[model samples]
Target: MDPLHPTVDPARFAPTLDAGATFEEYEALKAILLAGSAQFDVRAVGEVHTARPSFPLYTASIGSRDPQAPAVGFFGGIHGLERIGTQLILHYMRALLFRLEWDELLHQQLQKVRLVFMPLVNPGGMWAQKRANPHGVDLMRNAPQRAESGVPFLAGGQTLSPWLPWYCGRPGAPMEVESAALLQVVHDELASRPFSLALDCHSGYGFDDSLWFPYARTRRLMAHLPEMFALKTMLEQSHPHHAYSFEPQSNQYLLHGDLWDHAYDHAPPDHVFLPMTLELGSWLWIRKNPRQLFSRHGIFNPIKAHRIKRVLRRHADLLDFLTRAAFAAPRWLPPADRRMQLQQLATACWRPRRAP
Candidate 1:
């Protein structure tokens, strides 16, 4: 579904942050950070200023400070309307805090891997229940990368107007503050490690949930295809009937300025960085409750409490799986001798078509 053809009326998106109006989700997120401050290092990486107030962009981490340990990042709320994405990461962080008090094994696991959290990246947009930041730029589409060809009009990206959806920022302009802050966090933490994984959660797409890897700017296979295939093999072997579809983002559609693509492109070759986006399927929610199509927020998030709880539970194990995968990457990552075999398998699975 190209967001270029919005399901709901456009006027419904015109709301802005009003005087002293607090974003309840942001307040709840801050409380979670404060409660875990004793266990984690929490600091504001940047701030997004709106007409009403300036919201702090925070990056929190806990685990070994050693540069040799593997790292994993949990990111969400890049699109403000996708509130479930932000909530899921917070739920995981809160669970970690509770476990920190009693789970000795969790502490042992932390020593082997560094876990970083930036649960709410676009607070200004989230504050207004809009997908784009306060400057009206979609953080996911605000990066500097561009597609070569065959990109859908407006859907791939554009600078036509901020009033339209999927607006990539003006040509040659600096990245939005939130986007830059995320890149800095990736550089400071994930890219510095020998092996790392990042998962950025989102919703409002197809009928089933999808796990999309890098190369949103192009359909060409990433240099780390074998590693990606190895990861997929591990998941399938571990969960034979897992519900999520694991594939490349370009398989569904292409876009400009995908942050994960930008990060993978910039990371050092010696270090392996695998970034994936968890695009939860809101269409399922709407299928059960057809009226959701009329509400902008409903189109992107579960509108009911019970449904929201189910959505949270569905992705919990996957998050834990990713954490463990990063911690144990050395055990499963393909050795040089096996790289060609796995690469061949990956090509057969992901890029099956050939030119005539």
Candidate 2:
């Protein structure tokens, strides 16, 4: 599809939530998309059991007629309360359908790459506006490799407080339906597809955008190190408002059964690229300093609302950079040169520290 123009307004893509919009709203939105003429399939992966109602979680695919195109999976809404990620994926999908036209470049790229989206993976948790799924399980922390009990770092972390904003869920148990369903999907479906890259989005942290790569302890999974670095550099260079940062997948401070870690372990050896988590800023649903607006009423709070709009606008540019980077890398640079490029890009984005 011809890439959507940069001048497109953010309001056009904003999701409209009605008085009682819950998982039902998500289903409604999915139906609307399926009804359209666009090429999309809504595969019901599994169902979530919640107090409100049980709902099916799905993955949506959109692309041109290129079978071998590099595939990109966009995952969000792992944390129920982190609604922005879910909205961002939905907005991106809407743009791809209504605003974008598949041109020669888009067609060729689509053939060369596939884009998969899991817009609302934790419908039960989202309905309750809680971080954990229906059974109060934190889906992100339930990955088999780093199941809370299996990983010591996550066992006694300070972020595990129930009194805190988010509860990390029962250790060692894959209690959440949402997480379990996703785990199955990755093993059954994603394992079979020639998946090239994946980006899982979240919020309620750093003010700047942070890109986290897998196996933080070992950089071995980064076969396309230079290209990855170049992609990060291009993103940072193009969007100064969004700061770029990277860390190992198994950082003690952020250890868990994270989706990225799962993707790294399960994806085919040749796929090479590890899944990255894009952590955006604090939650718009929470009232905070410099913007003391209440969560309930701040959806329309002028300043907060503007910042949300600004982020949405920036996301469009980020998508463009990602698309170009994926397509241009393997074709343009040799292995050694690609490594050098990545190193340069990494150095440019890394912030040097000064002695106090």
Candidate 3:
């Protein structure tokens, strides 16, 4: 059976974020979530200034009933042009909220797992539909990943030139406002309740859905291979079209101080294994007929639309699985080993050429 044809209401699966939509739309969505009830908490992380104007960086949390339940976070829109990421999170939220209303199973899962949605991490960059922030700094690459001279290269990578889209900012200066804000929020939240799993959504990639873990250099991350493999299998079974692959790091053709990298590095050792970047597909931004008039951001492309629906459904399944696995296991798998096996399986699914 094709997973895309599930009998859920399409309207319930629709995204709250519109393509090429303004910051006002995002604020509107935030407002809606905030006014709903005490179950959700909507707050501003900070603000970013763009050529057009400045906008708030927002984070929304759907508090779980269980205090000790593992936290799950979904983040997107780090790259301004990558609107699909934001849409994916919105779609997931919609499905989750819908299910929570009618399904006891879903309600149980929600009570067991806290979910934090950072739907638009780079609102200023997203507003212009550009990759970098208004200052032309690629927030992903601006992380303090490496050291220079005798100090950390904290603000060194933000410099912009005519040659590239990813301009890391000036050395010793604060990183882009967006990245700094997200980092602070995530850090504080995790410090209190560590996350068991996280999915940072992105698009404009290969045809298959790819899940990338920590950089290959981080050998310690190899421990969580089993859990990652199980999660990928569950996702594939729930939504078959999503071809699952795992890459250790960004390709040489596409390298940066990506958000996932920073997230994994900062998370607790056991929690570190849970971070994965879900790269959807190249088809997300274009339709079957390239010339056919459609949303410039292609938010409504028919093929992409179906894929989004499928992913949202699968995400629901994944959420249930996570709740069961985290609480049921007598002894949870260690982080490093589980990650290695996940990388192995993902290599087979994503990079068949490199499959052993």
Highest TM-score: give the candidate number: 1
| Clash totals for all candidate models | 0, 16, 27
Residues 306-329 of candidate 3 have per-residue lDDT tens digits of: 655766665554445555554433
Off by over 4 Å in 2: 1-28, 35-37, 64-67, 100-105, 147-175, 184-195, 216-227, 236-242, 249-252, 283-303, 332-356
Per-prediction RMSD in angstroms? 8.5, 6.8, 8.3
Every candidate's lDDT = 0.87, 0.58, 0.59
Q: Tell me how candidate 3 scores on lDDT.
A: 0.59
Candidate 3 has a TM-score of 0.72
lDDT of 2 by residue, 1-356 (tens): 43211122223223445535455437545554554334564566788876545666777665533444455667888977777777777777777665445556665566555567787888777787777777655677666554333334433222465444335565665546677666665554444454355677787654445677765332233444555565555566766666556654443233445656666676777554536777775633343444434562233221356666876776766665666655654653336645665676554554232211
Judge candidate 2 at residue 241 and give its lDDT: 68
Across residues 246-354, which tens digit of lDDT does each residue of candidate 1 receive?
Answer: 9998887888888899999999999999999999999999999999999999999999999999988878989899999988998999999999999999998999223
Flag the better candidate by TM-score, 2 or 3. 2
Q: Pick the winner on TM-score between candidates 1 and 2.
A: 1
